[model samples]
Target: MTASFEGLSTSAALELLSVGELTPTGRLTEASNATLYCTVAAPGGAEAGCVYKPVAGERPLWDFPEGTLAGRELSAFAVSDALGWDVVPPTVHRDGPFGEGMVQLWIDGDTGVDLVDLARDTRHAGLRRMAVLDAVINNSDRKVGHLLPTPSGHLYGCDHGVSFAEDYKLRTVLWQWQGEPLTGEALEGLAQLEERLRDPDSPVAAELRRHLTGPEGYAVLRRVRLLLHHRVHPYPSPDWPAVPWPPV
Candidate 1:
């Protein structure tokens, strides 16, 4: 079921993503990992656009186990949704061209907006929410290009394959807010995230456990606790790369 992805509400698009039949449409040439574009179709014949990343195509990392990146992507979406940020377009794990993989509802982002500029600008509310997400996930790669701004004025983030590591590895272009106190809203978001993570049976926690290792999932709550205790944005770690290469 391949049709236009235009004009769908976020909730509607997400619901379709969970149950729609996937049909490969094209390949995204820019992705370093194996990334494919597809159309999702419901039994009723409606369709929408989505991106697919299969585990078989994921590159092995020295630190992370092989074939786990797809799950991290799903985990990131679960965390974002749990926080009610909706910063990550709805994503789910399922069978794909190669094997088990992730399929995310595609966002028709406004490419004209300068992500680098917005990532460095503290006044943008969307950017702030993304920063918090990165911190919570321990995102190791938050490249400027990963920040997608849609025409509907919402900012979505993608490429969360390197997140939720048990160690500190946050590297992003959003360090502009570093050293500043967390806004009241940010603190509240953290509190809510902490609550969700504390319950092993919660939907968000269960979903995350399916994707992340025990240590990695625990790290998420630990990071939330750290953020709440500090009540401020964290500084870049000098031991690791503080920003993604190419920066955009």
Candidate 2:
């Protein structure tokens, strides 16, 4: 049987998400954990232009034993929002007659280059900016596959389930910019984040303590300081797990 959100029944949501009624628009690429489709459904029948990510079946590389990938996706959005970053937000989570799935606002952009490609291209100055954001947020799984570019030259990021690791899992495709100087604006953001992270009552601080080990949590803070003060590049790791095929 397909999994579903705790309270919201999937059967009730399927009356709206059926492919025939809601017209799938684009055949975005598929990953190991989920299949992404551009669709017209507004999640809860609210608006159009939404991206549907359906998590079904097991894939080879998913390491999290907790049955909460959907929840993790939602949490990532929350963290991004808290830090004043733009991210796709979930519309609804349900599992019913249609299957277990999530709907989010579709981010329109050209296929993003992997961190490897971005590192090689000096023209992608925006990538350095992204590096600081990723580090501050403790994003661990930032592969080339997660960054999406738009025809209009805007870049958007996705697939942040393994972020905020609190561990030293700063693995990514963009390690080339490690040790580069951060812009003044980036430093300001890091300073604000450090203050928030250290606050015992802060939501982000509470989250880190709950989800991460003491060393892991400390590492996140240390990396932020390094990014802000030392211009330390992220330590490189070659054996990092590949972005799971068919991203969940």
User: What TM-score goes with each of the models?
Assistant: 0.93, 0.62
RMSD vs true structure, all candidates: 3.2, 8.4
Off by over 4 Å in 1: 1-11
Q: What is the C-alpha lDDT of each candidate?
A: 0.85, 0.55
lDDT of 1 by residue, 1-248 (tens): 11223766666776787788888979998988899999999998778889999888888888787338999998898888888888888888888667889999888889788776777787888889899999999998998888888876778899999888888898998998998999898898889989999998898999887877788888899999999999999999988999888778
**TM-score of model 1 relative to the true fold?**
0.93
Please give the lDDT score for candidate 2: 0.55
Which residue pairs show backbone clashes in model 1? none
| Per-residue alpha-carbon lDDT of candidate 2 for residues 1-248, written as tens digits (9 for 90 to 100) | 12122232334333334431344565465654654565554444533455555556324334454444554454455444445444333344545223665555555555543545554564464566566667765666776667766565555577765665544555556666665666665676668778877887886677556545566567767777777677554555456643332331
